[model samples]
Target: MVQCLSHRVELAFKDAMKKAPLYSKVYSLMDELFKFYHKSAKQSAGLKSSFEALNITPCTPTRVGGTRWLGHTLTALNNIWKGYTAIVKHLSQVSVTTGQSATQPKALYLLKLLRSNDVITFAHFLTDVVAVLAQLSKALQKRETCLYEVHQQLLATISNIKKFQTRPGPELRKVQRPDGSFAGESLTGDTTQHSAQMPKLLTALVETLDRRFSDIDEGVLCATKLADMNAWPASLEDSTNG
Candidate 1:
């Protein structure tokens, strides 16, 4: 009998930025924005208080660690997303008022970058995509998790992805324009192409997940069948001795 110990099904959606420069740019911009916000949140009492008053949670960006779990990236993206408006407002204020500061130019650059329609779309798309990976990572981290449960989680994630493909969910609307408008339909060129390819990416993810886990899936099914008491005799008859 063979029992598969551990397997990692690489999620295709996680690599959406590999061949696409726009996705990479969006990812980098989000991280850079988070670094600025995190620094401000830590150094400025007034900003922290503002966040609290505005009901925004203060958080920092987390990069992908050396471990198999890549949820930290998702978390970082989420934190930036949760504070998108606050970051924009804060950066704008700083860029306008803090002219003598050495970081003023960078702040102004980031402020303009954040206001772009493509950046907004890509950020929303990334947050949504990473969320799926985060759920799977959390499930796989459980101490008592089994292959059966893992399979179930994989299937659930795939279903969710399909749902998103058919009718892209609420994440797309999460990043509102700095002017308080939606950035849904105005995407153009590369960003539009990337966004339109999401369904294909998700479909590939589902296929890859199923292919990678096929062996473990078989093992899970076999184990489940063997564990079913009603499917087997309670006692085996002795052939030679009895």
Candidate 2:
């Protein structure tokens, strides 16, 4: 650990002009901050808290089998992930009680959904991740594209449920004129009637989504911003040192 820390410092000072280049540029500052994060990850709670305070997201390098940063990320995320699964189970139980179909198995569905999705292009992708994450912890990023998509899906479902509840009830059809002729009554008369409180139920469902998903969006935005903040320094470092 000490050797890693020493090399890191030596490398920075070895090229101080290149790394900190007297300009006080925003990108340069971000570059320095990013370095601090890489080291902090291994040290103490300070790393996590500082990054959280700054709302920065640490970028795990893509090289396989390099440092343990990715492993730590997985660990941190898995802890949250476990809690997320429990939340899904709880929600599913509620769905069963209300006779609503459970969403396709949460983990598999989410993984499949992302297979056809882009991580950086659309905000909805971020929203979906955050919405799932919210049952456990809040993200530091906001994914409007993601949140908006969820909102749209939910709104559509609410509309369908509303129509189901409001279509002309059979009872109104049972009424007859003072004369002997009955109203146009379908003799089978056994259509499944929706609960009168369905509109209210639909409204409650929409409200719940609004509250829960809204927070996820906030988390996505914050997390993304943090990552960017951490990335800026690295970006500038690469550009200058190159």
**Top TM-score: which candidate number?**
1
For model 2, the superposed segments whose C-alpha errors exceed 4 Å read 1-148, 168-195, 217-242
- lDDT (CA) for every model shown? 0.59, 0.31
lDDT of 1 by residue, 161-197 (tens): 7787767557876544454444222322234655665
lDDT of 1 at 158: 76
Predicted candidate 2, C-alpha RMSD: 26.6
lDDT agreement of model 2 with the native: 0.31
Prediction RMSDs, each to the true structure: 7.2, 26.6
| Candidate 2 TM-score over all chains jointly | 0.19
Quote each prediction's TM-score: 0.68, 0.19
Candidate 1, superposed: residue stretches over 4 Å from native: 1-13, 16-20, 37-46, 49-69, 98-101, 175-191, 217-242
Query: What is the C-alpha lDDT profile of model 2 across 1-242, one tens digit per residue?
Result: 22232223223222321322221222222233234224444322443443355454532211112343323223433332223233223333333443333332432333222221121111121122223223112211223333233333434444543443345223222222233222221122221221222244335444544444454357553354343333355676786986
